[model samples]
Target: MRRLLFWLLLFALPSTQAAEELRLTNGEWAPYLGAQLPHHGIASRIVAEAFALEGIEVRWEFHPWARSLLLAERGDRHGSAVWLSSPHRKETFFVSDPILDSTYYLFHRKDRPLHWESIEDLAGLRLGATTGYDYGEPFQRAEAQQSLQIRRLGSDLLGFRQLLAGRLDAFPMDKVVGFDLLHEQFSSAERARLSFHPRPLRSDSLHLLLSRRIPQNADYMLRFNAGLARLRESGKVSQYLLEAQRPLSLGR
Candidate 1:
């Protein structure tokens, strides 16, 4: 009777299983990525839910953008989200399909009233841009040739503030993000002073970058992409993007 009771008790106990976790790295780029925001931001939420469909949980490590890239390269983490695809990075990482569209544009004070039809149009102006970020080949080439006086900073938040202080005539950043940050870091009175140029400086798609050094990462990549496809087919991706536009869309 004791032996039978022992077996029955063991079989009746609930079974516990540990969830599979994917460690991903990234940096703060508001509305897209902010450690304090819900699901660590919109892009992060999308990536997490996509993987969740495959029974994978995401654990994000918020680091500086460059450091986030380094983490994936070193295989300290499985992958990094929200990076633009480049030939060199593609050679080293398993790049995912378009995670989101990134649109870069010039931002300046409303009082200054600056407009640039082309790269050459902004000649002689003091420009500000984020360090370690690629705006585009032409913009980079122009910077290399000293076409405009450029000031490099680590964050667009700082760059925008500097522009307000008259330290920089113009700064460049993502349109959606700029708007997102504007409401976050400034009040309506302060926001009235800044404006984004109608012409986009450059446009690119963001991707999830996975290191090739990890033997099993290839399979993980396939699962993530497949899950992402299901989300899109079910209209979840569209719904997410529309919701993301809420703070900016409703007010503006």
Candidate 2:
């Protein structure tokens, strides 16, 4: 009789006691995801807001980009934010609709004059890139084939400094990010010397990808997509990104 009573009480308990918090990991990629920026930068705010719309709270872990994606892929974390899609990632994780479209550009000194019609055109130059960045399949394959000369450093800041010091021939990054960092980190005179090639290297959409380890990963993607659509309809997504793009004083 006591056992029967315990089962009845347990069954009667409300299952909706509280919503489980979703975990995500990423690192500082400014004007996109930054712990110091408002709403933790545009991408962070979008991810948080999307989950919030579904009554889910987010628990974010900021770490290096490669490590963060690895955790999510391993199911140590539920999801990862603001990442470009790749064949391996598609096979490994459930990806949602694109959160943002990013354009990759090659930044170089104005005096050097750099141009590229194809990845082949960049073969001999010492290309500065961040470690573990997904520069798309073409660039990766070329690097693997030893068709491109690649020099990797810790961060864009390091790469930019290397370029300034003539240690790197060219550095590639998102145009918006390069400009923002240029504005934030360089003096007026320094800014004048830097410019990006007119042609874009590649344009790709960034998405929030869910780990396959989570049994309900697909459902989570659906919820996030719906929330993202709603946010788009409400114009919050555009507004948020524009806010992040506000110019910062180049020199303090």
Candidate 3:
């Protein structure tokens, strides 16, 4: 009886330790979260360090955003980063405090002579959006009800092409991504023809989304928030941004 009890305790230890480990799912979208060679990106680095602070190990899997979200939604994965929190997602997962702030800008041709003060201002305009891209509650709701002419494109680059060809009147995209795409994919003349609205459609906080299925996620959430606070206090967050932005600035 004593020997059997000791063997049972030994087996339980491994399972307990495994439960504390975290598995993160991400997609390859550059300048935010991507599956680049050495490491994913700055967000992944921040996530890894935050988990490390709490003695948690993180592993990542790269997939399409839709599939990645589905895995996390079903509790098949531990969590995901750089996701916008919305009422739609609150039921399936818990979101950490905002890890970053993102701005959604409307891009149009330089010759279009259109300006948008707000999302409502764009009503009836043919706007393009990337499939599976979440802007915010108001915009998403508007898009769903067909109040706006939102065309779903396969990729951001495609949307840019459509806009230039007059197929799409305008497209909504992140400022960082918009600049990157313009610099990388557009010719000098083409880049000059593209312009963005002076104001962003909206700005929102981005959070690290954790699966509720993982019993340890509550504790992990606390650690992530605490770690982020520490980074902010130490000014590390600003430093990280400066480093990440260096390459983008050099090209200009």
Q: Model-by-model lDDT, in order? A: 0.86, 0.85, 0.79
Cα RMSD to the true fold for all candidates: 2.7, 4.9, 5.6
Q: TM-score of every model?
A: 0.90, 0.86, 0.83
Residue 106's C-alpha lDDT in candidate 1? 88
Candidate 3 lDDT, tens digit per residue, 135-191?
Answer: 777789999888888989899999999999999888888777677677778777887
Candidate 2 clashing pairs?
A: none
Candidate 1 lDDT:
0.86
Give the CA lDDT, 0 to 100, for residue 60 in model 2: 84
Give residue 95's error in model 2 in angstroms: 0.5
For model 2, give the 10-residue run with minimal summed lDDT. 243-252
Q: Any idea how many clashes model 3 has?
A: 0
Tens digit per residue, CA lDDT, model 1, 172-243: 988888888888787777777888788989999998988988877888889899888888888888887776
lDDT of 3 at 116: 68
* Model 2 Cα lDDT, one tens digit per residue, 69-95: 899989999988988887788899998
Sort the predicted structures by TM-score, highest score first.
1, 2, 3
TM-score winner, 1 or 3:
1
Candidate 1: give its CA RMSD in angstroms: 2.7
Off by over 4 Å in 2: 1-16, 246-252
